[model samples]
Target: MPSDSALPQEDLAVRLRDGDADALAAVYERHSRLVHTLALRALGNHHDAEDVTQQVFVAAWRGRHNLDPGQGPLAAWLVGITRHAVADLLAQRARTVRNLHAVAAQPAEPATASLDGAVTDRVVVAHALASLGEPRATILKLAFAEEQTHEEIARRLDLPLGTVKSHIRRGLLQLRENIRGVRADAS
Candidate 1:
C-alpha cells in the first residue's frame, strides 16, 4: 500500500472521511503553507495569520466528513475554508475596535455622578435659602448671589450699613445650620 502522501488526492480525501488521522496530517503538510500565506496576506499580521492557520486546519478536520473528493480538489476546499477563517478573524477584530471606541466615547461614570451630586447640592442650598424668608433671604441674595459689598447691599436695599452687615452674618449662620441638618438627615 502507498504511504498516505503517495496516495492520489481522491484516495486521501476518502481516507480522511474514513477517520484516518495520517491522511489529515499529510493534507496539512501539503497545503498548510498555502493557507498561512493567504491568511497573512489578508490579515497583515503574523500572530493573527498563525492563529487563522491553526483555526483552518482544526475546522477542516472537524468538517472532514463533508469533503466530496470526486467533485473537486482538497486544496481548493481548504482554500475556501481559509477565506472563511480570515473573514471571521477580520470581523472579530472589527468588533473589538468598535467596542473600544464605544467605551472611549462615553463620559467617565464617576465624573457624571459627581456632577449630578453637585447640581443636587446647589438645588438643596437654593431651597434652604428660599426657606429663610423675608428680609434675610433678600439681603443674602444681594450680598452673596448678587455679589454685592455690604455698602452696596445697604445702598441697594435702603438699609443702614450695620443692619445690612447683621442680616448677612445671621443669614449665613442659619444657612450653615440648615445645610448641616439636611446632610445629617440624608446620611
Candidate 2:
C-alpha cells in the first residue's frame, strides 16, 4: 500500500476532505517547504514566516471540508491561505506602527499647564490598572500595553476567549471610573 506521503496531491486532498488526518500530515510534508519559503519571502522574516506556515496548516486542516480537489493543486489552496495570513499579520503590524507613531507624535502636556499632569495621569491609570488585581490587571496590560489580540491573550493566559474579553471590557470601565474619580479629586 502506498503511504499517503506518496499519494498524488489530488488524492491527498480528497483524503483530507474526507477527514483523514494522515492526509493532512502528508499534505504538510509535501508542501511545507514551499509554503514556508513563500511566506519567508513575502514576510521577510523567518520567524513570522514559520508562524504563518503553521497557521496555514492549521487553517487548512480546519477548512478541509471545503477543499475541492478540482480547484487546482492543494498547494495552490495552501498558498492562498498563506497569503491571507501574511496580509493579516502585515496589516496588524502597520496598525501597531501607526498607533505608536501617533502616540509618539502627541504633545507631552495633557492640555494642562502643569508639567506633571501627564505623569500624574499615567501614575493614576497605572495604579487603577494594578488595583484590578491578578488576572484582570495582567489581561488588560497584555491587551493594551502589549497590544495583543484577545485570542493571543487567551492562549497566553490559558483563559477562555470569552473570559479574556470580559476582563478587558470590565477593566476598561473600571479604569474610566478611576479616571473620573481622579478628575473629581483634582477639581
Candidate 3:
C-alpha cells in the first residue's frame, strides 16, 4: 500500500474495511478539527461544540458501512451529523435555561463543571485517533480537510470509482474500532 498521506479515499476505505487500524487514525487526523469547528460554531462555546464534534464522529463510525459514497463525500455527511448534534445540544440547553429561568427564586443546578467535562470529552477524541494507523487516517483527511469527492480523488490518484467506495466503507469500520479502543482505555 502507498503511504497513508499519498493514498486516495478508495484505497484507504479498502484498507479500513479490511480492518486496518491505521486508516481510522488517518481519518481523525484529517477531519477532527473541522468537525470541532462545525460543532463550536453551532453550539456557541468550546465545550458544547467539542462534545458535539465527538458525538458526530462516533455516530459516523457506527453508520460507516451503510454510507453511500456516491451520495456525497464523508465531510458533507459529517457536517450533516454535526448540524444535527448541535441542534440537539442547543435545544437541550435552551430547555434547561428556560426551566431554570422560569423559577426565579429557585436555586440553579450546579452544571458548570458538568459542561466543562463535556468539552473535555471532545478533546479525548483526538487521543482515540492515535491507535489507528494509516490509509484510513489519510483518506479521512482528504475527505474532510480537502473535501475531495470520490470522483475527484479517483482522478487525482488515478483509481477506479469502486476503489474509492471501498476505502470509505472500510475506513468507517476502522474508525469504529478506534472508538471502541478509546473507550476501553478510558475504562
- Candidate 3 stretches with Cα past 4 Å from truth are 13-20, 105-187
Model 1 accuracy (lDDT, Cα): 0.86
What C-alpha lDDT, on a 0 to 100 scale, does residue 73 get in candidate 1?
A: 95
- For model 3 the local lDDT of residue 25 reads 67
Best by TM-score: 2
Model 2: which ten-residue window has the lowest total lDDT? Answer: 109-118
lDDT agreement with native, every candidate: 0.86, 0.86, 0.68
Q: Could you give candidate 2's per-residue lDDT for residues 147-166 as a string of tens digits?
A: 99988998999976757867
Ranking by lDDT: 2, 1, 3
What is the lDDT for 112 in model 2?
52
Off by over 4 Å in 1: 109-187
